[model samples]
Target: MDSSPHKLYHVHGFDSRQFLEHYFSDKSDMAFGDDVLKFPIEKLRQVFAVGHINGDILIDLSIGSLIHHLYSASEFFKNIIVLKANNRCIMELKRWVDERTGAFYWGHTSTLLQEKEENSDQCQDQEAKVRSAIQHVVKYDLEKENMTDPLVLPPADCVISVWLLEVISKDQDDYIRYLRKISRLLKPGGHLMMIGALDITYYLVGKDKFQGFTYDENFVRKVLAGEGFIIDYCNVKERTAVSDLTDYKATIFIAAHKEK
Candidate 1:
């Protein structure tokens, strides 16, 4: 967006605890179980479907405040590097990784992933494994020449981006540009797993509103093909419309591999 960054609601304006409580709280009445939880569960299942994605390095270009996607990846990647858009999100994630005070509880999400994977039911064990796997939490700017500039990073065997481009991009062209930039960080033929909200324009954090780009499955397929990625798996889950927390019609997950 050409608009001033100050007017935009980036990670600093985001309240991590409030976001989780509102959308992912364990309350029985919350739609977290039905609508929100399926996105991560299905995404993780696709990761497994790819068959033996375990590798040395994994780069996460996701919104750092949301760590649920990392649960499944942590098991496959030996070293996990997370790139955040702002300082607030970095701090929020660090609090949980460092075991500091007032961190948002992600045990429920960890348990959900564990059970879905047929792993042990111990939530604490799963949490420990994720914490151990995450090696770094650093800053990243999608607009920068290199997403992780100043600090040189190794080409990752797998790159995971979830609900990031839609939130940061101003339009379709910008979204494709951002996608291509992130794809550059992957090793040739390496996997690129992404999750997005289909046909969403905006989402709110507390009283502030953040913009999102709208797109469909066909657009995603076309863009990936244009960017020289071979799609291995793609699917969209129709939203249940239980709450207006976000104005998305569906949740799309795609798993692709960069062509050599």
Candidate 2:
């Protein structure tokens, strides 16, 4: 596929609802269920259960309004602060958080997490836990040195960022810049769990095409080290589900803590 002449995500707004339907919906046939939903959840469940990566506060800055990864995390943290780049995402997420009408049904996702925990019938209970744990969802500007400046957020115990750099960053250096900015939000020795696509340059959400920043495992490690993080765990899952939505060869998960 040709990679040029694409619409920029920043210039043209994204459709968060369309995004959810195309990939995250359980009924969608775009990709197999394991790659999009279960893989990350299981990996995170393992990491969170290992007795590391915990504290009072976790600040989430994932792509779109994704909440699947938070199910494992809600079990560990006392408070989860979600930071978003746009109001649409904030509102979309709030609908689910508030249980407003027509909200995206994440019971399937809740059920998946529950099944992993061997609590096969606690889907409603699991959903309630997530809704209770996620106490705040605030909008922020990525371009600012302090993304949540003026609002004054407490330093996070861990920052969970998923596929955010794929669209917002222009290049590798830009990716590092955003990485550094979010790192400052962490207390020294605080953890960061990042999930990124390897060697992907673009993705389509609905009918609109948006850019995905290209990078590999080596580059990811280089950037993390340069930003003074100590790598504790890294996992790469090769893509098994075929789809026209994205072109990532594999999904990479890295858990690291800031060097104190």
Candidate 3:
């Protein structure tokens, strides 16, 4: 594949390598560490060891950690869907999913797309427009309480999301609504795994500005419990990552499954 600026996961107005290394190093360390071995990873290994996920439909929202989790899974899922509301991440997700078998990509088009354009170059321009659009205009129609339409996802056997609920809305009620939307996408008895970034603040995505939400274990458990998920496992771990020339720290992992 060509390694051009357009083809790259461009980090705007920031050092790309620093951001990647910091975040990914935190992930790599905790994932390989004994802490996760004791909690979520081990619990999930037990549940999935029985072969519940093989040949099942699995969904991942936010695509970032999902990409990492897919790499670490001992058994492969037959299908996975990665969802992103951001156009740029969606584009990158499409590229990533295409490289892996049995994966699909979905981007919420409620905010971008004034009517779809055909040209691929135009599509990139559309992503750029969406990136700029969210920076200044924070509110949109697809927000929490207003989310009335059923999410249109390809049928899947399991659903997984990470760091998605809290960032979507700051209001607790809205966060619950976000979880409910994700839960509705799953089948009964299906598995759900979430890796949460608890109690953090504003962060940058590429060159774009995004508002961040802080979550604690109590807060996250409340949201998940309200959404009908049981805490199969959770680990409170810290991550030190360089973002925008500063070291960012926060509690950074969660895993759960839907209740039977």
Q: Best lDDT goes to which candidate?
A: 2
Candidate 2: residue 61 lDDT (0-100)? 90
Which 10 successive residues of model 1 have the least lDDT summed? 1-10
Q: What are the lDDT scores of the predictions, listed in order?
A: 0.78, 0.84, 0.47
Q: Give me the displacement of residue 240 in model 1, in angstroms.
A: 1.5
Rank candidates, lDDT, best first.
2, 1, 3
Report the C-alpha lDDT of model 3 over 1-260, residue by residue, as the tens digit: 22222211212223333334333334434232232222234434445555546544566664232243442232446445555554545444444334455332212221122222233344343333322222110111245443323444555566656556645655577677667877776787666777655665555444534445555778878777877777766666665433452122444455566776
Q: How far off is residue 61 in model 1, in Å?
A: 1.2
Order of the predicted models by TM-score, top scorer first: 2, 1, 3
Rate residue 33 of model 1 by lDDT: 67
Which candidate, 1 or 3, has the higher lDDT?
1
- Give the count of colliding residue pairs in each prediction: 0, 0, 4
Q: Residue 30 of model 1: what lDDT?
A: 69
Q: Model 3 TM-score?
A: 0.59
TM-score of 1: 0.91
TM-scores of the candidates in the order shown: 0.91, 0.94, 0.59
Error of 2 at 47 (Å): 0.3
Q: Candidate 2's residue-wise lDDT over 1-260, tens digit each?
A: 44453655544557888888877887856474777688878888889889878999999998788899898888889999999887778889999999999898777887788778756564457777888999899888877767777788999999998888777777878888888888988999999998887888788876677887888999999999999999999999998878878888888899999999
Give the Å error, residue 173, model 3: 2.1
